[model samples]
Target: MRFIARFCKEKSEYFEIITIYDEHNEKEEISKEHPSIKTITIKNPAGIWFERKMHDDFGIIFEDAFDNRPLVHQERFPKDIHPLRKEFTQTKIEETPYLPYKYEEIDGDGVFQVAVGPIHAGIIEPGHFQFSQAGENMLHLEVRHFYTHKGIEKMLEGKRLEDAKPIVERISGNESIAYQICYRDIYLQATKQELPLSLQKRHALLLEIERTIHHLTDVGFIPNDAGFGSALSFASKLGEEARRKMKEVTGHRFGFGAVSFENSFIDIVAFNEWLNDLDKDIDFFEDWIMDIPSLWDRFDTTGILSLKQAVKYASVGVVARASGVKIDRRENPFYLKHGFSMANEESGDVGARFKVRLKELKNSIEMMRHFLEEDETVLEVAEICDGEYQSFCESSIGELFMSIDIKDGVIERFFARDPSFMNWQAVHIMMQKDIIADFPLINKSCDLSYAGNDL
Candidate 1:
């Protein structure tokens, strides 16, 4: 919060924190010694329940912006609230009652619906979408998420920033760096401390490596989903091979280093060496994917999302670029302000996104090759500041926005908005015009990580 507080504005003038938690059923006012902070509680809907209970008082609490206050709608904090609440035992909130059987009725000659996911024979998590269709065309689609909502945001409340790294990383395992990149910037804003100059370069380099790997994994999946699985096999192997070398470099499989505060860590030369090998593997994979005409034929004109909707929904990175919206963080010229050109395609289809990711992977290889050849002094930090600041970055997926509030060198407030949340809606939009059989195919092509959205 401190980082967010400081970064948002002057920490003293504009600091706000709001929180809500379920407790006992009593609607009692808690202590508010800090006049600046406001606390609101409806009631904690938990513990000794009445013989019969209705779901009237159960809902989410809205946070007040001026002061960090928690407003609870429930009459009591449910024992089911935070699984980690100290006084009450923890249990999965999933057991709580929910209305799931609602159905809409219609009288028509030949209306049909296709219920997809929540369980499919794919290496993907669960999601269910009921699409009311008329033969090959779709009338409406209702998406049923929460299949992977682990309440991670709620879990991070009141916890220290360092402790939240693992949680953030786990929020979406595949896009670990996007989360960590936002997480690190927010942490710095909260603490008002800059890391060593060498470390910042190291972070950027490592992040690019992660970006390369993530793109490979997902891009490879597109072909696999299209039954052009061979395009992905070698690419997936190279990606995994890249990860293994990165693990040897950072001592962690996913490149999660001393994240929050500085701590003693592992090798650097090894990272440089592995980066070179990664380039070769990527080149090999790229060549293999290109030779397969089946993949391109299926993907080329499929799932068209135009530029207007892409920006309207704030789509990020390759997804937006594939649709002809050219916005890349490296070109922002704010922080680091490196001279990098954006890779764009006006095709607005699965193939466009594929080409964009492929170009980005190439860019990563070039960027790393340049950085690795630099001397130790070249990447060294000459400037570090002590102040709160807001950081907005574009991830491989989309815009990664974060605010850090720092006070007394500790995080006071931290907030993050990932690109997946913004781009997730676009999937539904693009899928609308696509064929019934092409629905799953379109979704897999624009595979916006639902785990990223759940946060």
Candidate 2:
């Protein structure tokens, strides 16, 4: 069962909380206890409960910015109180639960703290990393990131609900289309609208395309870290070609314009041709990587993520799958109807993570081919509508839940939970007992986005 509580303001002294319960009995009990509080019972789409169970442990503890009282949830951390009340301002506070990293002194002779960027030599996003190490061995790594927090949620406030799509698209450039689809689904759900079969097929195809490119770029960096520069170049060329194909269909390299609830610019014949060529190249690339013994030697048994650690941190996506956590949202009946399946690997190491991506890449390609053949027509552009809406999407990375409250076409509240937020902690756990030099390779293997987490 699922439970969601949304805080509302009735007056300064009184707050009205609306709780949505999946079961009628639970809703009745809550309604009876409060008497004045509002409650609703909903039988949500099947399989949502499992997805929620896998990722329901995250919450922030902080002092209410307006009232100066501590605010936090009482679910996972029962001692905490809910701070997301209507009157509470969303501002930084001295007591906010997540603070900048402070490296504790490790007094051994060789142990010292090594601080790295909120900026770096590469063009990657900014995040501060503090390593407490003894010579080459890393004792502990603390990550501090908020440098790229664009106040994305705050930026959506007061804008027309439909107009917020472009802003949501930028939440993570690599996951742009996934974000759009999740937002679109939420809008449709709240408005009680459903897309036609053709549009649903198009949406799935676009999502797979986004997944393919992201994996390509991410996996490419792994070989680069292992000093296989040629593999990196090959992956980059494949990614570039994929993005070029996206431009042909959506008019944007990252697929910003191609996302919608109504239609798409899919040219099935052209896309199939491109997919065939890319498929051959990818197969060859896989074979080439398999032949490289050094790459395998560097990857195997490195950056191990155990099942116990995965459970403790509530890991998701490839990280969780690598550790034998068998929760894959694509197993839902809805995705099955669209011809997709979950991909998994059981080693819980860098090699497993890398193999998981390759397996998913192949799985996505098969889905793309199925979607293209199943629906052979393109869709013309259609206008978007604005209204109150909520949606749950099983994105390539993991499950994403988005909800927007709109009144008179203006957005009031926008909340989203990304997979990156759940998986970032796994990196810290994986870095343990490994040398500082392997940090880059370990990080590339996980590939959790700093921008996604900061937001």
Candidate 3:
């Protein structure tokens, strides 16, 4: 079974560590008297981050873990404090003395290191990347994020379930719709309510639109990073059009509040015309770009993530699909009935990732058109119940997983594992032996979200 997430919840006398997998879930109760448990990293490498995060949050020690370094807490961030403990409810805390983060070092005759950004020149979010290089070739890359960590999960604790929607929607700007859909799914599951087919199609329509816009942006940026400015200009134009259409259909450009049960007013004639135009423009753009040998030269065989590495690290979304992993949550009958088909490539390189995005964008357009034609229906809200629930959605980037525990109509605990959380771990695998100059191109092709991952 594929590993999903591992998180801890505080209890009066103990802490519960819940490990989620694709097929099953396991919970272990660790007595607060001695908060330690056997680590799962030996069998599931992906558990490293989860276990490390649990340690930082709840002071739960994973016995014999390979890497016990703090995941969320920075150096000198008060080693004695565990924020997620039930008793630590202060909104403010004192900072401890500064201590430098210990990044992995490589030693060799000509080895050198390049440190880039927790702050960058561009408008992108903060992340520190340390590259161990020999000449221009990168031997290894160690990425450190969490600078934008907002303590969103902690804030959700004890909040009314109805008031948590806005916070969830804003977790990732580009993935607002996906986050909203997942939140709604969990709420519905907890309340034992099912959405009608019409509403499901409407939700699917919004999700596909979000996916299309993001894919267009990435495909454009990838080419721009490769020095093809024309692709960026054209893709940006198309992306803007899509965003405008999104705002027309749902009052927000990013569809933040569009995932509700009510039917959205879609102008069918205008929508269909836009879809047709997009279809033709995408085809023309693809043909035009494919003829550029130089563009392919930059993209091909650069920043490769092998199929083995993707599977081993549990990579998701385009990163996994490009590497020949046929794992998409959209394979259900609901989506298949709407003309959805999985898009994949096997090269596991920058070129393959680009192709996968293009294919998925086209597929999303087709699916959206079909979903828009579904009949409209009214949805009824169900009373919220005290229970724990989990849900997953295929976000534009990859699989997004959310879990929430409701107690007396308030959120007791909440956790969301964004696709970026998994895909970020596989980035270094793609960078191995590649020249550092191609970092931007490789990074754009993957397009992992910092906000989503950091949260």
Candidate 4:
């Protein structure tokens, strides 16, 4: 195991292998089983750099990089390159696969393969899911994305700090605030700029509000898939209303041009009134969901993920929280911002996650109310600081991480990692024995945004 780790470190690149073991076992004990992972002092051990070589020749700032590790530092990221830091030049040589793709040679009857979209029913985004099933039950499910990939990382080339807002907002329309806040925070960190206190508070409150409504959608959708219509109808209605009212709070719910109450030009009073109305809606959603959980027995302990797998995949947010993996970016030591006691659940299933999200909505609504109740003068507030850094938070699905780099008054580079990249990979393992019909249910339950991931 030690030797493999050494080889991987030397051959640092994307998709390079790393060692993982049972969560209950000691590190030394796991090393004994796989004697090839080399032992060494590892810096920036939490984020991706430890997983690969340094970034391209540009500024790359990872949220998990230790102070002493230049490999993960912004300076090490190569300049004149791309997001993944992969090199691209004018002249290139390419090769094709030796053999064209072919079907699996399974030696059994009633074993079939089903290919579901890069497109699907109901206006969801594109993704290719190939399922190898025995009759109706799945034996293997492969998920391939990038259908909507528009070179977001590439499009960011030389974009000004403010210029990137449109692109950032487009990353995932549903995750507009999640992406916007991350982008702005990074730019601020790199440039040593500070957001208005009102903006900071409002951004946090809005993010939670997004999570609340987004969670409401997932909670309803998953049950709808389980053939429970009543729960779906009510939950979906709650989510729709929550989203509408949330949009009402910010003049543009999607959060375009939303800068700390939008100055004197916008009506702050109207926004507060909307938030007040949404608060009531959330209370009703919680009360109703409490009763609906008793109706579905399958949602209780279904799709259980052990702590080992959760850690291996680096799952975040509700997915990890449900399975006893407790990591929240709001609480991350590197962020150095406001601190809040995070809420979580231990049942490790659909119902339990639903419960946690509901509790979360209650907290978020309170934050919104607080912000709205305060006077607009708070927008002028500020706290200045020095040094460059990255910030992250738990979004609707999992951890959304962002990094910022500033040179003088300009942003050097910005990078982000959506939970879908990691959590989506775990679906193959989770759906190993799940039924075919249950695929959409499980997938929607995660509710990973395709647009956010396409980046």
Best by TM-score, which number? 3
TM-score of candidate 2 against the unseen true structure: 0.78
Best by lDDT: 3
lDDT of each: 0.57, 0.67, 0.90, 0.58
* TM-score: model 3 vs. ground truth: 0.98
Candidate with the larger lDDT of 2 and 3: 3
User: Please, what is the TM-score per model?
Assistant: 0.72, 0.78, 0.98, 0.71
- The weakest ten consecutive residues by lDDT in model 2 span 65-74
lDDT of 4 by residue, 49-77 (tens): 32322222222322333332322112323
TM-score of candidate 4 on Cα atoms, chains taken together: 0.71
> What ranges in model 4 sit over 4 Å off?
1-110, 259-295, 332-341, 377-389, 406-413
Indicate the worst ten consecutive residues by lDDT in candidate 4. 2-11
Q: Which stretches of candidate 2 lie over 4 Å from their true place?
A: 1-101, 104-107, 373-389
Per-residue lDDT of 110 in model 4 = 82
- For candidate 3, lDDT tens digit of each residue in 329-438? 99999888889899999999999999999999899889988988535677778888898899999999999999999988899899999999999888888888699999
lDDT (tens digit, per residue) of candidate 1 on 1-455: 00101111112333223221112111222222222222222221110010001011111122343211111212233433423222323444333343243333233678886777778777787776777777787766655554665545446644555666777766676667667777777665554556765555556666777777788887778887788766677778878877885676457778664233333343557765666777777787778777878777877777888887676555676788899987776774423343356889998898888888888888877666544433242222222333444566566676666654444444444445556655655666776666776776677666677776555
CA shift of 47, model 1, Å: 35
> What are the per-residue Cα lDDT tens digits for candidate 2 across 1-455?
33322323222343333333324222122221232422121222211222221112112111221111211111123233222433435455333354332344456787898888879778899987888898898888866555675656667777876688888988888788878888877766556566777777777788888889888887798889988899889999998988887777678899885676546456788888888888888899889998899999989888999987776666778788878877665676657866676767777888898888888888888888877634444434344345556665656676565667776567766766677766765577787878998888888898877776666
